[model samples]
Target: MQSVSEEIKIRPIFNTQGVCVINSVLYTGYECTLFGTNSQNEIVEQLELESEIVKIFPVYDKVLISTITGKVYVYNPAERNNKLQCVFTNSVIKSIDLDGEAIVLGTADGSVILSDVQGYGETFNKKMDGMITLVKFISLSSIKRRYNSKNKLVAVGDAMGTVTLFNTTGEVVYREKNCHSGQIMFIGELGNKILSCGMDALLIEHSLESEMTIRNISENIDETIGACSLVGDRLFMCSKDLVITLSADLKIVAKKRLNIPDINGFDVFGECCVITTDEHDIVLASVVQDTLVVDKVLIGDNDEITDLLVMENMVVVGTNSRYIRTICKSDIERQNENGLIRNKAFSGELVKSNNEECVLSMCGSNKVFYTGSKDGIISKFEVVTGNIRDSVRAVKSVSAEAPITAMCLYQDLLITGTEYGIINGWKIGDTLELVFTASASSSEITGIVVNNKKIHCTSKTKEIIVVNLNGGMDSSISGHKKGMWSISEHCQMLLTGSSDKTARLWKGDINSTLQHNTSVVKTLLTERAITATSDGVLRVWNTTTYKELGAIRITEIKDERIWAIKRYAGTEYIVSAGPSIVIIKDSSWEVEKMKEQMQKEEYIAKQHAIIFMKKGEYVSAAVEYYKLNLERDLKDALKRITGEMDISPLMSVVLLDSYKFVKRVSKWARSPYLFTITQRILQTAIENRIEISAKEADDLSKTLLRTAELFNAAY
Candidate 1:
């Protein structure tokens, strides 16, 4: 019997920060802690900063931390707090990079300033237009010295879409105006070439040869390129719409469209690239045959991932909303190689509460599930099966004086809002630990969400209260004139439904998306704003217009009163909590699932074929392998049955994975029949002028010489 591991591959990293791997140590800054970890990303050294850290840069043996208040702190294990130095600036520093012995700072004041680490004084400074977004250090060691012996180069990108390259001696080497139509987000260098990508949706390459020449390497790709990195000779760029890899010659090697958007950052190591999405999705993609194919995807329990560092065997992720987490790269690869069975939507099997009271609120990640009931009890359940009843294991229970109204997961913390207007936060691991409890509202606590290191909670008092996690001066945000029921957030917009018979959309920035007045009784947000009313009609509103697009009423249900609305991305289903947990049937979501099912079937068939091949059923396995477009497996099956079957039928199997087939045949150089198979395949490849690597050519030469020697010895 074959055993399959049912463990979820990727785990959650609570609040994270920008991560980088230095000499096998994962360095990252999250919230107030700047830490270093081992290869498995286990924290070995931790230091708490005075203020919240924004960015982390590794300069030589020390780690430099840039704070939100424009203060820079240099941390060294050998130096104590008093012995370590700090640099203070007036304006906010958005980005930092190391150039030679000087630390380059990109400030919000639109200036690129260099602070010498040795002297702890400003060595050079130059003012630019708009806020400086990114600072990158590029070494010109490979370039000829005739360009003035300046081996150190610094590239600064600003919000106005300009990229300027400066020499170590404060001399301008290259400048490009409007290199990107929008803010430049990324700047990476490979040899003498520089790659820049930004909101303009353009990827431009600049040559640092004799004269600086700029070229648009990518077309006006419609999606904003959020992050980019250079790996070997390939440049990996990711955006909301797609992930693309381009060669050094400006030709695209691979391109993959994404179903989910907003890739916060990515790091490339060897053949695979680790991707972190804004919604806390970590994905692994492999480069094969000029195509970037998604090998594995792990949905985090909670916490928005901010950045990641890819290592040879592991990945260290930093999050803005939680602490740092380390995941094994081998686990991701193993799950990808072996078919991974994804979690399906909850089949409406009720897990009755201990007191038989109605479960009011439910929120969970893939790892665990939490439910709150009218009994004033909060229960933690481990996910076990597909159905709700079987999937839940009542592990721990906590009680509140009042009935629980709302619940949310933030990293390891589980926050609960109760009717008594109290907010409780619990940190869960081997056991549940109550972190803090606060009297947040005078009336019933309605909705809650953690954002910007603050807890935003709405209540029957008709106001939203914002409290910092670290405990400080709390503030109340005024907008809703009546009691609020539910709150949902997407991107920068927060949607709330109030008892005043109105649904309000709060924009994080000046540019708001909600245009029309929505009078829906309740507004729940996801990628779209979904609303419900007393009229028993649930409507979907366009997020841009905030206008009704469609309406649906559940079949056989008369009341249609919805207590809560939730979006589940794993199954692409929108569920409503009311008389019954109703799954609103969506055609688009169903279509994607249908496609996935079809592909899953094909994958399962391929796995069965491999199993059959191991059992020595060649003919039947070959047919199944052919259906999966696994040409190499089909060829191997043919090789085993060479004398038993005609070569014509074996050759008829159309080769789809030619690269894998050639590479496989290259290994069977010692076998007489397999050697002939290898020679014939290479001959056909040469005749068809198929692309083959230099390693494959060398393997073919050795196989042919060995075959010739074997033939001479036989004569």
Candidate 2:
């Protein structure tokens, strides 16, 4: 398999429902299209079904697909007109997993059905008392070794926060009620233990022993764990916004928060793990002492990464669009100083578009930005910045089909101009509305700007028209020989680029027709005025002096035309937008300064926590450690304050990690002072209304009582 290129690839899909990888091929099923890619990242097969496919599974040479209409179809990619293999008229199939001798299907009607490979004979079927969300197949050997069972089993996780294990014979091997606070999202077998996670921010590990005891290992309120896998002694898991590695006992050994969209799925590859998210990026990470070190990040060009498959030395990735890419592992393993696997050069094309609308105008202040497409749609987003990069959240949208040619933002008002020379003023509150409309020109409005309570607009009429906010023409300056293509204002200077292949820099009022000017090829204004014309060459000039300082050629494209130049505030970088978006990084030293500030804050907090702990202020120390969110430090504080106090933090720990409390107390909390402390902690927790699980409370009581009897006998 070849490595992915520096330029991100693009794939198009109608609507991606789910993606899965089997053997050496990756399969993604969307609206009505089922596409497959091989290890080489080449499209090998595609089958368009009748209905939207919800889940897909490959069994030997046949592909099985479950649709939204509660039916399953089996077909060979090489064949046509596939017949319905099976129909569940009453139950909508939500998920499918392959087991030893049965295919398990989870349904929306709280039932699980196990059938033969061809779906002709039923093996086992049962209602799980709630909507079945996920069903994981457990091999017979693992179940027999753990619980001494003689039958193969399947683990069913439901929406009502229950996980039940049943044999292929429809007999329940073990059932844990209230395994999580909310609906269970994932269920899998991690080595000898049953691993499950839910929307309640809970990760549970259930032993396969006949007793089938339960333990709550991790809890994160901000995100929910969606996928997990086991590699050696380390367990890798991912949430909507984080990827973490934990010990077999469930202690967070390392973690990395990507701050991206919701994670769809992930699979482990060698020492590294590949993760897929709802956006157009795939992250590869490895565990290194208390940190999930990011090895590389694969970003797609205007695409959302839906699923991925990991082979020996290569990885196959699927996107929302029609493209699948295979990449070699060694290509990303190359070291870099910035720790980013990004292409040094910046160029971007439109990735996800429902129509052929090109983005024409974009403007924003700070992190909130808006873009206008040719289809007359305006998209609003809030930017989320982090230590490494930034992402966005779509806020709202507005639609109008006149091909918004010009836009300006002023306080709570947005002024827009259409190609038909119509200027519309809008008020943005709960919803966007047009408050006033006026005829600015008879020709297409090319560019618009708002300054000092006045809107200045340029059009194909070869004139700059000025209008007041209340809606009346203030002035008009006509000088350019041809229609204006772009316009900008800086420090009372009006810069205009026209189709005559020339740009003029006029340093005077718009009402004045005569001013000292400089003839240039084409021009855009930021801190400095940048010009480009003929030769694909870009020259930067001082806005005040108009002196040429530096120059570079746009070699990424043959015919380069710079249409828009936007600078991100607080950074020296600028984004040039046209047929493609290119980022020009001028000063990147600011990134190091931001990293240093974060490290200093963490160091100061840790020192303060140590001081508080040394002074025997357990509650104060615990509060500081809680800010760090390390389980070991929090447990130490809990042990120190056991009998002396009952704080809310301790109660949270009890509810979040009960297994640690019980196991740790049994091992090190054996002395008389420690035993008394343990008793007091549990007693105070029960009296003060901590929501400890029944299973945990019982285990703690039984273990303590048995230990007390042994101590009395020894004494």
Report how far residue 80 has shifted in candidate 1, in Å: 9.4
Judge candidate 2 against the unseen true structure and give its global Cα lDDT, from 0 to 1.
0.61
- Give the alpha carbon lDDT tens digit for every residue of 340-408 in model 2: 433221111112223235555655565565556566776665555545434345577788668776777
TM-score for all models, in order of appearance: 0.41, 0.45
Off by over 4 Å in 2: 1-11, 22-25, 37-44, 58-62, 75-91, 140-148, 207-221, 231-233, 267-274, 279-715
Residue pairs clashing in model 1 are 14-322, 14-323, 15-321, 15-322, 15-323, 16-318, 16-319, 17-318, 17-319, 385-391
lDDT of each: 0.61, 0.61
Name the runs in model 1 displaced over 4 angstroms. Answer: 1-17, 23-25, 35-45, 77-84, 99-102, 115-121, 139-146, 207-222, 257-261, 267-275, 280-715
Q: Write the per-residue lDDT of candidate 1 for residues 28-100, one digit (tens) a residue.
A: 5546666554433234556777787776666677776677777776677555353346856465667777656
After TM-score superposition, what is the CA distance of residue 657 in candidate 1 from its true location, in Å? 79
